[model samples]
Each structure stands twice: as structure tokens, then as C-alpha cells.
Target: MEFYLKENGVRTQLEYGELDISGNEDYGYRPFQLMIASIAGCSASVFRKILTKKKIEIEDLHITAEAERDAEHANKITKISLHFIVKGENLDKGKLEKSLELAKKNCTMVQSVKGSIEVVETLELINLSN
Candidate 1:
């Protein structure tokens, strides 16, 4: 919430890190990018907590986010799709799906924009324990 107008440009740093909002996409972090990052980061944490609490041992977890913007409506994000790749041992598809659902509900960023943006989540569980 707090910003510092440094020599380069305006920047904000908090729980995540320092972000430059100089309006130069190449040199600074765009507001839209930060929004998506918040969603992805919150979802990842919540999802991990849900799965771990269920006794699932995770080897790796990766989240990919893609968004569609409405060009006719001031380039606002219309839809966002999240793809999760979870590598783990004895992973149950049903449990993973349920965990993802819980994560989407509990994630603050996702909850904040749930009514405005269409969010889709897909979980790809890779079971290494065979």
C-alpha cells in the first residue's frame, strides 16, 4: 500500500517484494501482472496447506496462469485459467480436486475477484509412488 518515488520511478514493497510501477512493462511490474501473481501465490499456498493437511506428501508443485483480456472493455481481464501440476506420492485425484476447490474458496485474491472474473482450475497430479 505504501509507495516510494525513487529516482527510477514509483515502487511498492511488502510481503512479496519490491515492485516498480513505472508504466514501463519492460522495466517495471505492471499492475495487472501483480494481480495475477497474487492470485497464483495465494492459491498455491492454500492448495499446499490443504493437501499436506490431508497427509499427502508433495514432491513438487507448479502453477501456470493464463488470462484473457477484453479489448473492447478497456483491456480488463475477462477470464483466468490456472493449471496446476502436482508431483507427489500416492496422490488421489479426488482428494486433489477437493483440495483445489478449497484453495480457490479460501484464497483471498481469488475470493476478491471471484464475482468479476471467470476462474478455471485444472489439476494434473503426477503420482511418482508406483
Candidate 2:
């Protein structure tokens, strides 16, 4: 992808649309935010696929990510925590937990940053039957 230098940041045009990246949030998305998003999005997608393959139906799935950055070292991301809120009927907690483990193992983005960034995943299940 080619990025053109803008006033404050850089802009890239893609098939879907244009992407603006900047250090300043006022101009565009921050680099760290995008990194966290990539990790979380990849994990969630892989987890959902694993569940589907196991015939687990879900009403909804949401993921929240928190990143810990070190101020002393160029504000680099040191760790990321991902919390998953899963809403479904008759959801097996054990199976979901296993699926999450498998997702962590298989997610490309998670694997990419394995040695550099610590990734932690947690799950909260909401049973529709309740």
C-alpha cells in the first residue's frame, strides 16, 4: 500500500476506502489504536470461526481490547488484554474456553506479535436462556 504524506499524517487509498494514519488523534487514527484493533479483530474472527465449526450458535459477540504502553520506550505497546462478551443460548463455558485457546494459537496477528507483545484473552458468557 502506498501512503501519501498529508499535513499532519499520511493517507492511503484502498479498495474499500481511504485510510488516514497519524500520531495525533485529531488528524486520523493513531498507530497504536490500529495495532490493537488488528489484534482484537483477528482474534475475535478466528474465535467465531472455531465456534461455528463446532456447531456453537451465538446471538452476539463483542470484544474489548486494552493496551498497555510503555512511556519510557517510545510509547511502545507492551501488552494487550482482550475481553470477549458472548451472548447465546445453552453456551458451554468449557467449550468456549477451549475455542479461545485454539484461537490464540491460530490467530495470525496474535502469532505475529507473540514474542514482542503479550496478548491475554478473557471471556464473559451471557446465556439467553437465563
**Which candidate leads in lDDT?**
2
Would you estimate the TM-scores of all the predictions?
0.90, 0.97
* CA lDDT, every model vs. true structure: 0.88, 0.96
* Model 2 error, position 99 (Å): 0.5
Candidate 1 residue lDDT tens string, 1-130: 9998866568888798777876568768777787888888999999998887988788999999999999999899988899999998888889889899999999998999988988899999889987
**Segments of candidate 2 deviating more than 4 angstroms:** none
TM-score of 2: 0.97
Q: How well is each residue in 35-93 modelled by candidate 2, as lDDT tens digits? A: 99999999999998999899999999999899999999999999999999999999999
